[model samples]
Structures are given as structure tokens and as C-alpha cells.
Target: MLNKVYFSALLFLSLTLNAQTSPCKAAHIGKFQVDSGESGITVIERNKKTQTEINEKMGYKARYDIVWIDDCHYELRNRTVIKGKSWEGSSPTDILKAEILKVVNGKVFLRLGSNFSDEVMECEMIKIKS
Candidate 1:
């Protein structure tokens, strides 16, 4: 009886561990929204190799090529502006680095930075669609 109980507990533990998947993997293909302060909401849709963002209030829409450095680290490159003007003085060749800090509830927190500057921005994106 003791051996059976031990085996059952081991099985339960294994199942629990397997159920807890890494957040980065789940985030790869999802629709997320980030509040862009006064500019309104930025809706982002990401796939395996691309990310697209649209901010209607800002009249901005762009698509980026995604390069995954690791599980939690990735870079966005080759931005193609589809609508509105690009940021002043910003180049299309600039790379944006992002690190997944954590996912709480339905929100994903990130450490966002750029290859061209030392500035790092922290923001959270709410999962809209998985």
C-alpha cells in the first residue's frame, strides 16, 4: 500500500511539472495589447518569425522580423512601416531587444531595449488571444 501511494504521488508531481510550460513558448503565437499611455492601445500579434503592431490612436502600424536569441531573449529587426510616419531619427535597420521578465495572470512583463541606445523600457502586454 505504501509503495502504491508513493507511485501515485510521483505521477502527480510529474504531471504538475509538465503542465507548467514556459511562458515564452506560449507567447510566441498570441495577440497581446499594451497601453501606450496617451497614445492609446497598441495591439500586437506575433507568430513564429514575425510580429506586427498596430496603434490606431497613434496612426502607426508596422511589421517586424523576429529573431529568437534564446527562450527568454529575442530581437526585432527590419521594421517595415505600413502606416504613419516612422519615429523621428529612428532607422529601419535598428534592432529592438526584448526579454520576457515574467507572466502574471494574463499579462506578460518585458524588458525592452534597443541596440542603438542604452535606454531600457519596461512594459506589460495583456494576452488578448492565445
Candidate 2:
């Protein structure tokens, strides 16, 4: 009957639309909330606390801009902080490079290097609610 034909066409259309995947989708892109940590057993515990962190090279969490380059390629923007401190002997802003890294759980994860190299940073980042 015509009713059966109509139902089949509708089902096909639904499946086809759902099959298309885009990287720009919300499930694909999200704001990354990052936390910096230090090495050694003693320093590891302090890293978990947002205020009690011991790493000076890379400060605490910041909102990261994320862009999906491709299915496997992703990028992260420079760190951004709140209104710069106007206190005496204090720098207003800290500018960093756009560290292009890998994406996991809709976030950009970076692993630090052994010493001063980018090869040692081993931390996971998660998407932040804007």
C-alpha cells in the first residue's frame, strides 16, 4: 500500500541524516579547562589543588580555545587570564604560544617534557563550561 512506501522513505531519510558527522558539532568541540602540575611524588599531590599548585612554569587552569582541524587533528589556543592585577610590581597579562596538541574527551591534552622540553607535560584537560 502507499502507506508502507511512505514509511520506508521516511526511515531512509532519517538514517541518512544521522549518518553525517561534523567536527564543528558540540559533541566534537568544547572549551578546555586545563590544570598545570609539577613532577616528583611530593609535587604531584599539590598539583591536584587549584590554589595549592606548585608549578610556576605553567600556572593554574584557564579557558582554552579549541578548534577541530580534522577527525584526528586538533588545536589549542594561548592561555588567557582574568583582568590583570594592577598591583605594584605585577605584570598585567601572560601571553603564551598556541600549543597545537591532540584532542581527547573533547578536550586538548598536553604532555610536558622531561625537563624544559614540551615532551614531559603529562596532564589531561577537560572541556570547561563557558
Candidate 3:
């Protein structure tokens, strides 16, 4: 009696947790665009196999090497300077951690974290190309 109820509760909890997990999938490999309210349009091109990302925002182009922490989260380390730009003073390497918060109807909700702060920004990206 009591044992059966306990087992059912545990099972329900497990199923709820499983359903809430957001996993990264191959469908995320593509070109996406985000229309930032103030910053203008930002485009992101991602290659899952190479773990590389190219971002264009407000006319500046940057590249990053991505390291996946899990199916839903990844860290991006800037790789843009290696392409030809000369490094000036000791500029801190820009890195950002991001998580796929949700994917619905070809759009992805992303939460991004910058190296300089604990604040997180949420943005929605639409898949432009696969």
C-alpha cells in the first residue's frame, strides 16, 4: 500500500526530470540569425562536426572554437585574432558559455554567459540555413 505509492512517486519524478532535459542535437548545426533590439542583426554559423562557430554582429566578424560540456551547453573561446588581426595590448580572451534553453518550431532559445560577468542574456535564434 504505502510502498506502492512511494514507488509511483519516484517513477513520476524520474519521468518529469527526463522530459525537462534539453539535449543538443544535429538539427542545431546550421546558420541562425538573431535580431537584437538595439545591437542590430547578428548571424551565427555553426558546424557541429568541426566544433567551430562564426559570428557576425554589427559589422564585426568573429570566430570561436566550441567545447561542448554536455548536449545542451557549450563554451566558446574566441579564435578570430588568428586570422590576420594583430594583437595589440594584453586583451583578455573573450569566452562565452551558452545553453540551449529550448527549441520550438525551428527557433532556438539561447542563454549566454560572458566571461566578465555572471549575468545571463536570453535570445531567440531562427534557423536560416541547415
Model 2: residues with Cα > 4 Å off, grouped in runs: 1-18, 22-29, 39-68, 75-123
- Per-model C-alpha RMSD: 3.7, 10.4, 4.3
Tens digits of per-residue lDDT for model 3 on 1-26? 99999999999999999887454563
Tell me the lDDT of candidate 1: 0.93
Alpha-carbon deviation at 116 in model 2, angstroms: 13
Q: Least lDDT summed over 10 consecutive residues: which range in candidate 2? A: 42-51
- Give residue 93's lDDT in candidate 2 (0 to 100): 40
List pairs with backbone clashes in candidate 3: none
Error of 3 at 40 (Å): 1.4
Q: What pairs collide in candidate 1? A: none
What TM-scores do the predictions have? 0.83, 0.28, 0.66
Selected candidate, larger TM-score, 1 vs 2: 1
Error of 1 at 48 (Å): 0.6
Candidate 2: what lDDT?
A: 0.39
**Candidate of highest lDDT:** 1
The CA root-mean-square deviation of candidate 3, after full C-alpha superposition on the true structure, stands at 4.3
lDDT of 2 by residue, 11-114 (tens): 99999987976433422433344453343221111111121112334343233344445543334333334333222542324222233356555564544332
Weakest lDDT window of 10 consecutive positions for candidate 3: 49-58
Candidate 1 — which residues are off by over 4 angstroms? 1-20
Q: Number of clashes in every candidate structure?
A: 0, 8, 0
Clashing pairs in 2: 111-121, 112-119, 112-120, 112-121, 112-122, 113-119, 113-120, 113-121
